[model samples]
Target: MVNKILISFFVRRLPEIRRSKGVTRKEIAKGVGITLGKYDKWEAGKVLPKSEDIARIASFYEMSVDEFLGLTEEESEAIKQKLIEDAERLSPEARKIVVDAMTDKQA
Candidate 1:
């Protein structure tokens, strides 16, 4: 249920991104090396694009696949909240040390 809703929302985002790029479905299809019908199906939520095709579309739109699908906001926030929770479970000094170690690439 949630998956379907997200996919539908993601499909809707495609056209908005395309218009921002000043391209139509035909233009994006040509840019991404696909059929206009197929691309239209994607935007219409009649078909979900595969990962590779989504990556290609994102590239064509000058955005990452994550951004293209609108995952950057909601998913990123979830991940950040998870990280904060994990950090809180650890000692404060330990948290800073972990961040520093990762930044320093000491591993």
Candidate 2:
């Protein structure tokens, strides 16, 4: 028989990450399909959401959880590069909008 273990790390960057992306707590709560108070708890490091919620937030930010937590700079850059490459396949107008939005958030 084989045994497997699962480990999870919770880093509270939700507040900062949401702010950096110009997203309000309410918006994140709605997007994550959770109550605002629950989201607030998650952001304040008072609690952790389900793994599904973590994945949903990462998807919303177009980043992996590790990248969202600022854990792996190089890996995060690789993810950004991949996203950029995928964005390049979009129509010029769409690409421009996405690029502009990305640029605006970083500013």
Model 2 lDDT tens row, 25-95: 99988986789998877765567764446556766787755555564667656755765786677777656
Poorest 10 consecutive residues by lDDT, candidate 2: 1-10
Candidate achieving the largest lDDT: 1
Off by over 4 Å in 2: 1-12, 73-107
TM-score of candidate 2 versus the correct structure, residues matched by position: 0.52
| Candidate RMSDs in order | 11.1, 8.9
Instruction: Estimate the overall C-alpha local distance difference test score of candidate 2.
Output: 0.62
The best candidate by TM-score is 1
